[model samples]
Target: MNKSLIEKPAGCSSSILSRCRAAMLIGVSAILGSSSSDAAMNVGQNLDGITYYSSGSVFANSFKACGAWLTSPVAGGAWDTGFGDKGPSTDAAFVMRTDGYPTVVPFTAGGVSQYVHTLAPVYENGTHRLYFTGKGTVKYSGPGVAATTRVLTGGTVTFDVTVTGTNDLAAYNATGPSLRKGPSSWYIDILVSNSTDPVRDIRIMRPGYNTSGRDTFDSDFKTKLGFYHTFRVMDWLRTNNSPYTKFANTNGKDGTGIGKDFYSQGTGRGVSVDHICDLANETAKNIWICVPHAFTNAGMNDMAASFASKIGVGRKVHVEYSNEVWNGMFQQATWVAANVSGANTPQKYGTKAAEVFTAFKTKFDAAGKGSQLNRTLAGQAANSWILDNSLITAGSLTDSIAIAPYFGKVFTSLPSPLPTMDQLATDTYTIMPSVRSWLDSHKTLALSKGKVLLCYEGGQHYVGTGGSENNEALTDLLVDFNRDWRMKNLYRYTYMGDVNSRGVQLFTAFTLSSQWGKWGSWGSMEWLKQPIGPNSYEAGKEWGIRDWKTNNP
Candidate 1:
């Protein structure tokens, strides 16, 4: 826990140096709203003390709502917004826009029906200013929040806000037809104290008849909100999402997609994301870094140590190689099989993953974090081949074998006339047995070999057609059902210790923060803008607050 353990990597490449520059510019923009639109003029002036932020780059494309899906659309295609030569500009403004609308489930149906935008919260002009756009006049009710102007139709709206610890929010669009259709989105940021420090709470509140954006704010609303419970245990690196480059040009998605780009690792979006500043501002989080296969050692270490210093050495960290190595949809998957010498068979992908793991481990260990780390191994979860094959060396080469046992994939492939939420729940629970079997066999095998089992990514791999007008009602049902069932019990705890399976110990919810519409519906619960409620991902982290506090304290 000493400061000595907080190591900052030296000798970053020229590219990383540029990235640091981009990151620096973003920090400044976060405090002083970008001079792009009227939202900045009004909102920035009204809410003088609050800061605003989008998940990643606002220009990044939205993950495309309700269309070709799995059959015709590409695999892992939806995952990558834009990367490589086709990425975003590092000089892009800090914005929060998505490609398509990840339609919302009506609030009346127990789903959040809106999008949540984020601002980092800054104080100027005697008060911090916050701004966002809504469908109609909506009244926001929460802790220490007062809207300067909440009227008219879709344009920049401003609010004067203050926060202590975690805050709760709800919007009432009286002029709009109904809560579900009227309220568009609410932008919120949390502050632990009056100090000028930034708050990283960016959960979106969607319009809905049955929406409730509640969270298990375990951390004192006065202290480092939610840090003890959620932030401490989380792997923030987002492995595959990290984009290390040659010219600090995050070339990452900087925002064109619209409402889809939740986290930036793809086309560097808004303010050209450099998560280092993100970590420094919200220091409670532990990163889940996935070192891009092509990144330079200096660049990778720079990111690793920067994260270590912010998170501190006392915290446990996960060093994963690439994102999803087995999935052929991603570039990494294709590159691994085609390029890595003998990395031909699907089994060999794990071997490649191990290589990346080893490489990063050497860097972290050199940085004096040997005892505070876990070298995670990635593998295909649904398949039995990866259950106990080349992916592991019993007790060596890996600390945990990552698996993906999603419950909703079964429902996604069906054509139209989708089953109701009740049916979805029924069918999902029915599949639990087989899922438990698969997890049990693999989990048992891994534990026997002295390696821990983790869900590298797990969630409802299905995104309903709710984003479409025709399936809107059905979407509401699905969202409601997911919220009532899948969101909490199933994803975070339900199968935690099933009858037969040893149970997945630590699994990343397929993903963490995602834009509204399909990706926001299921699997990843890190954060949801629209259908986001108190029991959203925030509650998931809160589930272990008491235990975490007791153990760590």
Candidate 2:
């Protein structure tokens, strides 16, 4: 699940009393927030249609980042676990920082004795199999990293070992001799350690890979995620809690000649806007961007100008300011509450959103792409009054009002003895009417405001909350429910039916894919090419979305 899914439950805050009351009245609960060959031909038509949700962030365990060159953020210290700029407190035995290089040459026994490491996505349990290609003298130990005499002298090293129980990367150990002299490209197919040991630099560091103007994104990533009409990059860009306050602080260059060598991952700022635009171009999809809340006016203008100049000629751009500013769980909400002067949080968000919209519009107009720009105002789905208040300030500048009308929140806090899969399915049928009512009111509101309604994020919100997620039995039940055919039917028939009938112009689901654990089963499919069964469990939410799209088209 994306970071957005880890937010506090709806109505948890006092500011949203109305939302809670509205949710109760409608029987809706908890807030959560597809295709290939045939998808390409319908690109133009799909722009006004549904698109896939935003891609997940670049993490060691990220399904999106797997099979790619980049891994998790580098850690540096004596024990091989330090992050950011924390200097080594004890003897500096080893160090692996950003720029994909270790300052230290050799790994000491003490340094590599016990250390944290990065693991490939979906390699947490069972037998781990992977290949490494690089130039290094290293040894590995631990359940996650197979114990082996590692040798990477321009040849691939293979690891085929079974790990019992949970494979924790933090318990890995490593020992290595001095790295080979001269520049060498270190690429690991797996066991990319996110540690402070010298081995980390060798495994995670490699230069001149993406600079050749070749495909930077993983082929699997493109094939699995590229079919969307528009790609929302809220998570991809790391727009929430953004560290960028100026254009110079960004990772990639802007304008026509956007730089090829962008530091896409291993930093909080995330993939640069230039690279995101490149992704949109490569996939032949429209782009949806979330402006960083911390960006200055000058910085925003620079980003907007770059987006205007670089986005593909025919593709559209959907612009929103930050993400979920109404939710206090995010920094953007606090930022608006403090920085932007308004009567309330909604008004402040609206004011900032209008500014952001105007900035992009100005640049798009100057670039003769104004018609392709769609400015969106995102509001809480359960609370129409939030939209009403926000639109009062930003309606004239907005093209659409976006909401995340997810279902299954009521299940998050269900009592002990969780409902059986069949019972859960039956209960799901009861919730759609309220959900449909919620959509109808929002659609009505959007129409009254002379704007189309858009679903920025929406899907089944069946995950537990308030520590209920930690209940292994409940987690099993929820995961099984998502896998059931009933879940797919709910999405294909009930959920999409409600969305389409309400006249939603565009609907993007919550996420693409991620591992289903205690965090929440937010992924439509756990991973790309995860076998959909002839059995009901095999065909999960992704199949449902595919069926809906096929039928709707």
- Candidate 1 residues 103-190, lDDT tens each? 2111111121221222221111122233333343333333234443344344444443443322222222244211121112222211
Candidate 2 residues 1-553, lDDT tens each? 1011111255332111011111222222122111122321111111111011112222222212322222222234442333312211223443433432333333343434323232223324444344344454544443344456665555555555444444222221232211111111112322333233333322221122212122245445566555467667676665656656655432122211123332223234455566677767887888777888878888779889988998889888989998888877677789899999899999999999999999999999999999999999988776788888999899899999988766654444657566876666555444545555666678889989999788777666665656675676776677677777767766665566556656677778766654454445555655443544435535378777766666767
Each prediction's TM-score versus the true structure: 0.52, 0.69
Q: List the residue pairs that clash in candidate 2.
A: 29-409, 30-409, 118-193, 118-194, 533-538
- Which one wins on TM-score? 2
lDDT of each: 0.35, 0.54
Global local distance difference test of model 1 = 0.35
Worst 10 residues of 2 by lDDT: 44-53
Residue 406 lDDT in candidate 2: 64
- Candidate 2, residue 46: CA error in Å? 15
For model 1 the local lDDT of residue 291 reads 60
- TM-score of model number 2: 0.69
